[model samples]
Target: MAARLLIGVLAVSGLGLALSLVAGTVLLRDYLYGRVAEQVSGLSQAPDVRPGAIAPSRLCEVTDAPAVLPSDFRLTVIEADGSVRCRVPGDQTGPPVPSVDELRDWADDDAAAVVRDDSGSWATSVDAFDQPGRDGGKGYVMVAISLRNADLTVQRVAVGGAAIGVVVLAVLALAGRMVIRIGLRPLTDVREAAREIRHGDLSARVPPGKPGTEVADLSTALNSMLEEIQRGFEKRRESEQRIRQFATDASHELRTPLTSIKGYAQLYAQMAARNTGSDAGTSIAREARKDVEQRRAEVVSRIDSEADRMSGIVEDLLLLARLDQQPELVKERVDLVEIAHDVLTAARAGHPERRLDLKVEGPVEVEGDPGRLQQVVANLVTNAIVHTPSAIVVAAATTDGVAVLEVRDDGPGMPAEVQHRIFDRFYRADVGRSRRSGGSGLGLSIVRALVEAHGGSLECVSSVARGSTFTVTLPRAS
Candidate 1:
């Protein structure tokens, strides 16, 4: 862009100089010749000389000459009948005057006027040498003037002027380029800062440059974005550490209770089995057996459910860690429609009571990690199944330029507040209900992370008592 601007300036400057020079030269040449012609005509009228014996008139040679610049062109005067009296180029070939077609073309064929000589250097005005005190009067005396070397001087000036113009233009263009670079240097800083950020240096920031340039504005914007990213990562790291610590603490706290319950239940079962032959012991053992069985079932269920919940949290943490380190490989394109079909098939097989409808759109394909994409779908589906445990409706659609994979359920949906935090780890809308249903709240968060890793987004649309819809939108590769 800078090169183009500089070249345009040079072109405009050259055009202007050439036009002005040509116009000024033509005007000056016309005016000078007009003045000389008028002066010569007056002199001829004053004194008439028209006889055979031509007498020399007292002509103003240097005195009548106009004030010419040092580099002005020279002129020579001669008779039309091929007799050279004075020469601009100093007639070397014995008195035959120089002839010029260009000068001849400008004047009428019969009309005598001051004209440029053949050498293109001289202008000549012929004033007839009228004999004042001689016979019969009205005779002609050819007044000749020469100016050949003067044209050479004028040409040298023009060439020098053009060369100086080119040198000045080149110097200005070079200086302008340097100024442009210095002004936009902040852009380079911003670009390098972004490069560092991509290399996992989240703290990298662009320094703002001096005022009033695009580069300064760009640097500010980049620094703002970096600040936001840095804050988000700091919060995420802190949350991850807390989650890991919480999981460990929960495991330790629950372990002792689980062991005691299982041991007591097992001991009671043995007692019931051994005392079946005795009346008192058998009656006591029979009641103890019922209590023990109830306790045992409850303890096993809690342990199993809690362990499963903890395991999901750990898996989610691992996935986030992997995502932080490096996203999944998008080495190959995957047919999104094909993966949607598999998810639908699984849903149909698993939930026979619920209607799982799969509507595949046209050739839905994306450039992403297939494994990650499928996992994103499965997570949404699982969320739909749990929320709207029955009547699952799985559908796929592509609109405009994006592919949307949805897992919808026809059960009661969540409120606005609950829905917002649904994706946050372990954030259950109904704590008691989630506990009863054996749910760990890391499912949707994991789904969000996985979907984002595939360069996709997740959204939910739900209303009171109405069905909830989870949609995954990804860019379809064309």
Candidate 2:
């Protein structure tokens, strides 16, 4: 690119220099030729020549001739009889005499002509005069000044101008090359950055250019695009990783329940087979059957409980999938305080020994799906009650044009790191304890998704041993 730009610059500059040199040379040559013509015309009007009276040997002598004539100046006389005589200043041989036909062609005294001969080129003019004693016979006086000096001067100027033009072009090419390289440096940086990005280096960036220049604007635009692309790649990678982890966790969770169900079924089958093959008295067989029935009942109850747990996990997973797809929600005005009250009431009934409290500052009306909002309140309250041994407080209020619901517990709170990923599906802070307590770990995840779907946000503030507070903020009903 730099080379192309440099070439373009040189081409334009060189063309301009060439045209200037040509024009200067042409103007100078014309001016020089005009000056020579003027000199020849002045010399032609000199009253020095009397061709008929001068002897052939003394035709070159002229008393009235300019004493300072140029050494290369020549004079020629042609009498009526077609006799020609030529004379040059300072003994320099001049151009050959003009032929009779050529002299006849220059019959006008005011006309000037350029004549070239073996000696050199000359600017020549002719003046006709009648001889004092001749009858209808005229003599011609011709004056010529050499054009060699003018031509040489023009030639020198042309050559010199061309040489200077070449030098200027060379200098311009060098300077233009440097300027083009510097100007295109930003583009070079951008190309390298793009190449690096293509090779999987997302952090590479183009160097900045001068403000308000086209290259700067381009750099800014390309940088923005690269940043967006990098962000997109990061998000995609993170999503894939989450999907893999989710699949693994889901499989593990289902396997646990399936393993228990399988074991209980096999035990039930063994108990039945043993009873059927027993060869005993009727009372003994009857007692054996009663015991087997009681054991089978316990086994079937456990199997049902595992199946219910598995069903809950599947249902939560499906709900998350739907939320991920951004399903349309049933939007309506719902009172968050009422939802908190109901969730607290259920908690109290479920855990009579544990103290649960509900605080309502106001109606806290918000626009959202009622079922989903209630579920959100229930999940947060349940999580507090299950994780903390202290009394749980579920509160709802309207603050700053938004409906806020907070579930607080004075228990062993979590660390900052745990709070950050608490809403991740199937992520448990206390994995063993959560599994033993039949916690599916999808409760908080579902809560977050539901809140976001309603154009709300969920946040958890926690610190070890102090307390944990889960706050959900939703837009107030308008």
Candidate 3:
């Protein structure tokens, strides 16, 4: 761009210089011609060049021409009768005289004239000089000066103009380059920042540019967008990590009950095979039958128990997957108070040793799937019962447009960090307790999912040794 600008400027300058040279040369030529004409007009009035009275050769002697003129000047005398005489006829390089027709034309008009011939250009002036004898006779004087000096002067001016124009163009090009560099500096910084970002450096930012300029606004906007993208990228990475961990935990939990059931089934098959062995004595067969029947009953019972545990784990996993993929639950107005009561009753039956309390100040109703809502309450109550030996309290109330429910426990509370991840899939506050008590570690995670699917949110507040409270807030049905 700088180069183009410089070229444009030089082009215009060259054109201007050419025009100036032509104009200056033309004007100078005219001025020199006028000066020569004036000198000729003055010398024509001299008394020495009077009509027929002076002989042609004597005219040059009387005029004192060399004293009054430049070295290059030449004079021509024309008599009234049409004869021509030259002062410097022997100087072949001198200026030429006017033609015969030119002299005749000058005689009739008696005015100054300019004529051109093979020799050079001449400035001529003619007027009637005083007649010396007879009727006044017509005479003429023509003075010619060569234009060589003016041509030389114009040539010198052109060369100087060219040199000056080159200097001016050079200076302009350098200045233009400096200005462009300064203007593009901000953009250069932006380009470098973008390159860094491309290489995974989201923290890179362009330095501030001139305020109120387009470049400044662009930089600010770009930085803001990069910050948001970096934040999102970090969040996504965390989510991916959690998902991977969830899968591993889920596999481990499912494997435990399956392993138990497989062991029980294998034991039953071994016992039955031993009891079926061929025996010769009836007494021995009878005795083996009694023992085998008793052992088979016990083994079957154990297998059924493991099967129940495995079934529960499978059901919980399916529900979670369903909630994640498609949470299109049947929405209806369900009473939170009713769900809380039912969940507490079920929990109390399953955990008879754990004390459970239910408090319903008022009937709190929300729009959600009743079955899923009940599951939410059940999961929370079960979670409380499994994790702690202390009393569990279930509460429900309504205020304004919100339905609130909480299941809290007076058991050993959790740390702040543990509380934060309690609702993550397959996360357990007490891993040892989860394994021993046959807890799937998905209860709270499923609770959160179900609540969120109903356009509600669940939060847990806990402190070490202070107990933990799990709160659910739902939009009340209007």
TM-score of each: 0.41, 0.89, 0.76
What C-alpha RMSD separates each model from the true structure? 15.9, 3.2, 5.1
- Model 1, runs deviating above 4 Å: 1-313
Worst 10 residues of 2 by lDDT: 48-57
Model 2: per-residue lDDT, tens digit, 48-109?
A: 34334443235456544455254467776668666865454535565556666767667564
TM-score of 2: 0.89
- lDDT ranking, best first: 2, 3, 1
In model 2, the runs with Cα more than 4 Å from the true position are 49-58, 61-69, 81-83, 89-93, 96-111, 117-120, 132-134, 280-291, 331-333, 431-434
Query: Top TM-score: which candidate number?
Result: 2
Give residue 241's error in model 3 in angstroms: 3.0
Clashes of 1: 17
lDDT of 3 at 184: 76
lDDT of 1 at 223: 82
> For residues 180-222, what per-residue lDDT tens digits would candidate 3 score against the true structure?
7687788788889889989999888989878999989988998
Can you write out model 1's per-residue Cα lDDT over 235-264, one digit (the tens) per residue?
Answer: 999789867955654454345445655675
